[model samples]
Target: MTEAPAPATPAQGGEGLGDKGLSGKSLADHLREIEFDPRMIGMVAALAVIWLGFDGLSGGAFLTPRNLWNLLVQSASISVMACGMVLVIVTRNIDLSVGSMLGFVSMVVGLIQVRLLPELWGFEHPATWIVSLVAAVALGGVIGLLQGALIAWLAIPSFIVTLGGLLVWRGAAWWVTQGQTIAPMDSRFRPLGGGIEGAIGTSASWAIGWAICATIAVGSVVARRRRRRFGFSLRPLWADVAIAALGCGAVVATVMVANAYALPAGIARRLTEARGQVWPEGGLVIGHGLAVPVLLALAVGVAITFLATRLRFGRYVFAIGGNPEAAQLSGVNTRKVVMLVYGLMGALVGISACIATARLNAATNSAGALDELYVIAAAVIGGTSLAGGVGTIAGAMLGALVMQSLQSGMVLIGVDTPLQNIVVGLVLVIAVWLDGLYRKRLG
Candidate 1:
């Protein structure tokens, strides 16, 4: 009898082998198949290139502690809102009203500090920062809940509702202030705009440097453990370690550079001599250092990351985003989830508004004028899919930074305001288009 034909080995495994042909592939080969998209890689690389170009043109000042700090602070509000926006977008929904909502909340916060608190409770300490923050955040949550109900319970399309809200809220903001601007914030609230930590001078920088390192280390460890526990695939340990190390190095380097700034050198020394009499003296130093916005962004990022990765709500969010019907079928409270997402978005916008108010030291009826565009653009640029079900807080933050950096750089380089606006609009369109293209490629 003819012997049974030799069983095919992996190399001769029919179609599977045909796919590989003469190419040898190890386990790493399988990993490569599921690697990050090329477009994503290219986008990130492009950002690096732009940053480098700007750095060169600005003679390294562009990347200075002061500038970097400013960039961070400027991006913070957007980044925070983007976190919630990602959740909303992941659910295959959009909220066009966030900018207006944010404006309204900022105005409310200012109004509370100026008129409401004093009127409502007969207390005029002039230090209503904490109270204003609480009221603003609450206002955001309430708005979110209402919108969520309209969308989830009433089945109203998010686009229409939020768009209407955009108009309504902005109108309300203007009405609240009677078209007057609110300014002259409390001294207690000033630091949120741009404050320092540490003993000022060199020690302050070291303190901040260590803080960043610690944060990165803790975050990396927590993330790695969570991914492992959840049975999610992860980058190699080496990769993780490298990222953490690199982040720490970057922070330290940035702080050192910021401390070298003329502003920091003099101010830090003064702050140091004062012996903790003041807040730390470093935030976003041009060419180096941290910015309040950056710190705020980092804080928001960490919070959202934990919420997304470490909580059941986050898992449901991803689930809903990926397949709402399936998620609902699986007994997930789809309505509650939707409401929660809107609420969270509202809260984020509110927080962002507070930051914006602090930054500007005023609540303009235009506090968040047309900000929805930038928020959406940043999220898309940072790899958040418009189709939903995929996004990262880190990506959103980075995207905002990229956008803000481009704007700031253009201004510094003397590109006219109109040209800057045109370029930014184009960038937003390109980013969204690229995201769509990337999704199609993935599909």
Candidate 2:
């Protein structure tokens, strides 16, 4: 029988191609690819430019250390929630209940501090602070577990379940507080969320935070190499090194900038008089440190990144997102995965509530109000796809920072809160639309 034309060789594969005479692939194709959503990157870049432009117009005061640290603390709650939201969204689901859950947790914790802790079933202990925290977190976890089970095992739509949770949790929160505010937590607890570590000029805690970020960055690079080796994939060493170094540099810059503001006026004068003599007994110190919350958030971020990037569970998460059917065929327990993701999100919200409560020094009935929108916006704006399957902790953090900066900067610039809300809402719509457009292009 007459044979068809012979198959083309790799060299001959490009013969019919125009100009470059190159194949479809290149050396870069074998490297670890860029993982961020394009829409996210664009939004982040735009927000960053706006932040810097505004700071410049404001005579550089907006970029001070105090302001930066404030920004980090404010962003932390949303960023943590966004990380978990990323997982939920990747599974093609949304958790509208997070805000109510947060509020519930906040109210529960506040009550523990104010009422529950003091009345311990009959007897009271002066050491109720620890008990209160544990109980608050446990309750949060339990709620999440129940909701996750309902969504995963019961096969109820996440929308309905979480919507129910939103209403239920809000009522529970109001019930717990009787529509009143709880305040004046223990001094010890305050420091955990609001206390500074180090002298006025140098926050040792912020330094530690940067150190943790560096460690995480290094660990990520090594883990990436190991993954490539195991997958039998080829990657250029230089690229990994470059990426790792860039990450470290960014962390250092953030920490440094957040601590680089002028020492408070009192500290400055003391340092001037001391002329660098032993900090002049509380003179403006170079090492006056940062708030404890900043460090706590950094530590949390590092741990989450490690879990998401370097673990088998994390791999399953991405696989399930990429294609649930394929992942199921490959032996992944899709139901369990979904349950675990929601549970994890619940735990994160619990922790976020603790931090927010501590920072506010009270859990008002309005705690976590409207926070869900901001948290979700941060994730989507940072590049988490609402349709599921792709996201990063770093991207979520960046997104949170961008959102917080915009809000804070707007207020600093005399923009009304109503206008700010309108702006953020518009940005959210634009981001989602852009994401949809990119998906269409890819399809």
Candidate 3:
């Protein structure tokens, strides 16, 4: 028999190519070989630019510790929802009802705390707070389950289903409140939103920040050792160290600024009075500690990141998004995956409702109006592809930060509300366009 052509050796091929030609380089070879994603690097650079640009425009007011802390708090609600939203979009689906769901859940939980659970059951205690939270999650999940069932089992389009849900839930919320506001909720409930007394002490904040840094450093070392055990190629040890250092530095900076702002007005006055010193003339005085809402958002983001990057369900989500037919052929139950994704989305909506309501200290029918657009925009801006199968929880949260920063910076710099919307809409369009171009280049 005639002999087949000799295969190309590693020495004869390029850095990542192999004997079998271009197809021999797996997707992991192309992507995981890099120390970090270029997209992420670019996004970080953009954030820096925005920070500086706004700081300059606002005459140094934009980067104030107080402003940054407020920014983190304001962005927390959207960031929490964006974590779940990333999975939905990754699976090539969208939930238009998140904003409405937030409103509805807020009203339901508000009623439970303010009227229903208290007067009906004659139960008003710390336990009632737990009950209200349970009700919020349950209500959100049931709504999501209903919508998911219709879409996944009955083959209803997600857009159509969620679009209908959007209107239905908003109207339901209005009905629950009878077109009135529910306000002055429980004092214990106020901590969830991080009001004056709800924030942690400065010492606690710094301790948490350092603890995060330590955890990241340990995780990196453990991960690197595991990869070595498997004989997988690793970037230089210095690269890993550098990344860890940068992360720690960021944590330190954020915590310090928060500490600078942490000396609250009332607390500061107490300190000044005790020391018998008058407060500095026209000096900056800001709030103390990190907001509870920010901490909650961070927790959600970390949990979702672990799920999306380390779990089987997370992998299936990406598979479904990348190519549903192929994933199905490979034995993935796409319907179940889709349904679970939406259900998870519902739970996230509940968390967001709690935060939003706590922030406003009231439950109103319009509590979540137009928030859907903001959530989607945050995901898109964070580098989640609308084309599906590509996104990260961290990226989506970063996107939320960027969106909020822009809004806050513009407001500080005197941009009109109408103009702010116009600018944000433009940013969304540009982000999608950039994503398309990046994908095209990869292809």
Please tell me which predicted candidate would have the highest TM-score against the true structure.
3
Off by over 4 Å in 3: 1-32, 120-124, 267-287
lDDT of 1 by residue, 1-443 (tens): 01222334434435453343344544444335434335545566767877787888877868765666566667778888888888888888999998999888988888877677667665546457778777778899999989999999999999999999999999999998798899866555545555453113455567878987998899889988998898877777876787688789877776766555445555645644666554444643222244555566667888988998789999999999899999999999998999999998898887888888877888878889888878988888888887889888778877888898898888777889999999999988887786787557544
Q: Which parts of model 2 have CA positions greater than 4 angstroms off?
A: 1-44, 119-129, 195-203, 206-210, 213-237, 261-283, 286-288, 438-443
Residue-level error in angstroms, candidate 3, position 136? 1.4
Question: What is the model-wide C-alpha lDDT for candidate 1?
Answer: 0.77
For model 3, how big is the CA root-mean-square deviation?
Answer: 5.2
Superposition error at 206 for model 2 (Å): 6.7
User: Native-vs-model 3 lDDT?
Assistant: 0.84
Worst 10 residues of 3 by lDDT: 1-10
Error of 2 at 43 (Å): 5.5
lDDT pick, better of 1 and 3: 3
Q: Candidate 3's residue-wise lDDT over 137-221, tens digit each?
A: 7888888888888888899999999999999999999999797889867777766776665577577888899899999999999
lDDT value for model 2 = 0.74
Candidate 3, residue 415: Cα displacement in angstroms equals: 1.4
